[model samples]
Target: MSDDATPDATSERAAALGLTSPAAEEGAAGPVRFAVVGSGWRAEFFLRMAVLMPERFAVVGVVSRTAERGAEVTARWGTPTFRTVGELLAATDPELVVVSVPWDVTPVVTRELVEAGTPVLAETPPAPDAAGLRTLWEQVGASGLVQVAEHSPVMPAHAARHRLLQDGAIGQVTSVQISSTHMYHAVAVIRRLLGAGFEPVRITAQRFAAPLMNPRTRAGWTGDRDPVEASTILALLDLGEGRSAVYDFTDNQWHNPLRADRLLVRGSHGELLDDRVTRWLDGETTIDSPLVRSQSGIGQDLDGYDLQHLSFEGQVVYRNPFVGARLSDDDIAVATLLDRTGAWVRGQGEPPYPLAEGSQDHLISLAVEEAAGTGQPITTEREAWAG
Candidate 1:
């Protein structure tokens, strides 16, 4: 902790580390008490968020299947570890549990936690396939406690666009062209941007190939692999009412620096292409402004590089809640999910990303992949969880 730490930071750091502080109890008032199942790379995101935003989150325990891995996580993160979900639940009373395992394993752990009456913040692609999704829904769809942590829509840049669309800054949204992320992740962003509910839609998609250099991952990039031809998947989502979305993504687009991100939100009266917004203020007037971002701790600011917020036209649309945490936009989004999940569990807010929304996103995503592979326009159908 720094000498100039905020009161919340001081108390939270003390409580999270089990220091002899007034707030270090099991039912502490400050941080959202939670635990995680799995200790893989994605699981580390949850741990890092808790560590960075101690006031907003607290990790009670991590359930690892193996003793060696559990010991490794314990030694590294100083978080208690249990061998089984049963043991973890018995030992620590977390208000929520985050399922950060592989797709196949996600439903099982989520089911266990939901059956035990604990709120769960599940990872993306809630299940492996549509059948898995239906089966999982059959088990826990009505529980009203599972919220998937799909961070793209809530990511700072994307969230700013969402806010702008919701305010009708560009008039009625007509279409969105997204070239960031892939598959289900891209679908989540498109759905949110288009304001499309769980409505049935048709998808026409195809895959193309191109050569590109692959560099970097969450771990590191040593330029170890040779440059190779990568495939690009293009999908057209025919959202009803003439509203539509174009999904264009290349393999490793998430980390590839060569492919610049492109976002074009076309509305009836205006359009937003990336940071620039072109909209009509009146019949004879058109205005343009850039989505400005405020960052702290870059030059004169000693706090360190942290995303402050995003604003358009002097109106603050997205404000980073975890300031001075040195987190990226995506990290902030995940932290928001955890914090909101906590609030929902405590009856302070609505469910963040309900299971139905995630299922629908994946539902369309699976259709896109199928359409791309089969050269056909596939239509979506209402699932059991859809409203």
Candidate 2:
């Protein structure tokens, strides 16, 4: 944590993360006023989004723990940047706050924001571990003001697979299978598709202390706690209803990273195998699912992350016949969902990704991590999610 972390936590300026439509009378050019809570790498992405969509959103204020880093970003973006949350809030009054700090800092930041009456779209894992995530969830339940927004779940690929299953492209899903070891994303993708109302019957994880080839290990990237590199985590999730998904994430091959991500969905009627995401009507190509894979550079909000490179903009798996175009169905779904979510925030209509519905995923992922840590099966309450 940075030196001013303690003061930032206790300060009243560390506003929460969320979106609230300004009075209809506020009108255009007024923009959706926002203040980013961090000036780190992730915060830079939100800054870029504000820059790209100036007509819709404006980043009027920012707070960073590091004085130098804070000044640098403020100078570059020409926004009011401060060393503490109190300073940032004292300088500007914005309608929305976007939290873009690290994973570990999320809970404290969230609590402060919620208490201060700010709505947040905090970054993911929700927290570093299960207990931390539960605490954040409980905090949000009590606050009644903060909004937990997760992006990867909003990344297009997962959204498409979700639609295929819901629309009955696959028969009444008797089973489900997700294959990936990326931990955060794998668990999120699985729960989103399984409708967040399913229970886990079993979970098993295997780990190996392998090396990862990255700047974290080579250059001491963030700090000591950031694993220079350690690989070896393959987990299999067994869900009743004859559904299952295998998660394979080990750093063994990461020393020499390969095609990093992949997902396959099988159902009674069809299967979306690998990057193609093709399904067969009676196992024939003529019946292939007609959804276009939305790989990198396609429909990127016209000019947001791509030109700025503040955030990653590419498919989870690249199987495009064209180089650099890793389009897939899962990609399309997530992209569409994000558009819908943004529109909802702008008061155009309701969001496709329900906030309450999405919370269930966080709960399930927490359970998976617990099962992995304990080497045991954990069960979730299906009926409890009836909200």
Candidate 3:
């Protein structure tokens, strides 16, 4: 269960619903009951998380269009599958639904579920473009039933960095330099860290081309012997109030070790370069600290391998809630989003990342691509969904 989840409430709800939950059986809160739509590669993240953390999450069913796909998923994940959302809902009630599908299909699936009154955690780029976003907003934006799985903000290192900023460690962040994830995902982290909060802004962007070796993936390394031409994009965002961000990324940077991840956050009193932090301590003294990481379950450790937490200056900034799950950094972040979403649905916590924030993230991302293509600065304006 999430740190914020109430054990008694979950168990009581499960018992009242006549559902046999693992948590309830263990005399604790039951896991969050949710379903997944679209049985595909990305859907594996939800499946794996449920498998790894059964006490925290439960999969009611998976929505697949074909019996063949449904059988495949069932064989691998031990979860029943349905051909449609209505079929799944008719048999069982899930508090949340996760939509993982192609870019264009997201808004349609999410709209159907939201109109059906199911809370949804839609995949990134909630819609493919601004027009679709506007249409989605007009249809169900005010329903308060959608959250985007933009997980970068909750990634361990990034979460620690945001905590520092939130705690005034940097004395009010002024600028953010990110060459981390690409496009919408990167924009989400940038806006969250800078505390931009859907503010209107302008973006000027450019792209450069180069050749490099694109190495590994979740599957494994691509042993291909040739270098591929890669495109690099740089975007400057004016988020108003002297709060700005520079987004730089190259194609396949997420898995390309040739291009290391880079982040620089600047504030009134100091800056953080990667893990190193340099800031003014008392107007007259300058101090430096490093974001230290802890890991276990390696070598002689019998605890099983996983990330523990991130600390700075003798303080734990971000701790992994799924330590025994053996999840990767990205998986941990996504799981955190799922856990938080469950808590939000139960009215136990704040909305994880609302649809408005996701829309704004993608809106800026679309502008970045447009600016890169047009060689001009693009200004962001208030949308009908801005709140």
Candidate 4:
């Protein structure tokens, strides 16, 4: 650990690693005023972020599908709620609107917001399936008013690794293996690491079942101690041009303690497995380094138990923009997405994650499930969004 490294040396190392603190990258843009179009469990992530960092975000209003839901949200958050998007817009001029409805309703809400000439930050898997995705892309792909809330690539650890790959720390990234979150979320990380963009892919997959104890979930523990049958799906994606990705997922892996998340990025010069990176420094020199995280309030420290930043080889690779917010890594990623969306809507930053990219991730993920079910290889074709 190079905690005592000089500032100049650390800055040089950080530049070499292609690391830029988020605050430095995106200048302070002030509080972003936005409204949410749904009141589901996922919508609370956005609401909670506003509550945690009121200086950075302001939830202008919430648009629930029903008056009861709107009242419930207003009762809990004390933020005004409306029964329709039009009502929310008429009351509050939010800079952007977040669409967090169900899978089937996402495209509709997104289209409505787009037609209203409002910038939108839509939830993942912009559409339900391939056909829906194509149709939605045809309607709004060119409007440049939509950004998908794909947060995996922005997670601190994953963001650090992506920066390293971008800097060629590990020569040219050839392949990636991810066994983290399920479906499109994992695929988003794989595509980001490989720098794959709407490329046609050939996928082969298989599913297996085994008995595993299931305890915890996002909701909490299910006291049933019996081992239940769990399904695991493994897939191989060939994205032409010597690039590939391995997708592995198991039911309840996100919360199951028995299943640890894993990631592997193999490049021409080296490979990064989880937090440790092994790379060739010279003809005869191979170096290994671990990604170190700085957490406050541990033992002697009393800064109130929060993640400060992530560092590699003494260089700060990724710094938590909301240091004192005390948010988890996942929440940090989501909040970053929200912040970037606000910036993009104001034309201050690049689009966080475009809808086309999210569509491709889901398209590939859907093919994986299809391949596993049919026991046959599946190849994707170019879609409307690819153009």
**Where is model 4 poorest over a 10-residue stretch in terms of lDDT?**
1-10
- Give the lDDT of residue 219 in candidate 2: 29
lDDT of 1 by residue, 233-289 (tens): 998999899999999999878877778889999998899999999999987899998
Model 2, range 83-187, lDDT digits (tens) per residue?
666666666676656677787887777677767776555655456765665566666755444444555554544544565567666565554455444555566
- After superposition, the stretches of candidate 4 with alpha carbons farther than 4 Å from their true spots are 1-29
Q: Estimate each model's TM-score.
A: 0.92, 0.68, 0.91, 0.92
Candidate 4 TM-score, true structure as reference: 0.92
Kindly report which residue pairs in candidate 3 clash with one another: none
Q: Kindly give the stretch of ten consecutive residues in candidate 2 with the minimal lDDT sum.
A: 304-313
Query: Each prediction's Cα RMSD?
Result: 5.3, 9.3, 6.3, 9.8
What is the per-residue lDDT of model 3 for residues 1-387, given as tens digits with 9 covering 90 to 100?
Answer: 001112234344434433333321211447888899988888888866776667888887888888888877766666778888888877768989999989999999999998799999998989999999999998988899999999988899999999998998879899999997888899988988888876788999999998888777657798866788989999999999999999999988888778899999999989999999999898579999999998887799887677989999999999988766677898998889889999999888999999999999999999999999999999989897776
lDDT of 4 by residue, 317-383 (tens): 8998888777889899999999989888878889999888999999999999999999999999988
Candidate 2 lands at a TM-score of 0.68
Quick one: best lDDT, which candidate?
4
Off by over 4 Å in 3: 1-29, 217-219
Worst 10 residues of 1 by lDDT: 1-10
Clashes of each: 0, 19, 0, 0
- Over 4 Å off, model 2: 1-30, 174-181, 198-201, 209-230, 252-256, 277-286, 289-291, 294-347, 351-363, 380-387
Per-residue error at 200 for model 4, in Å? 0.3
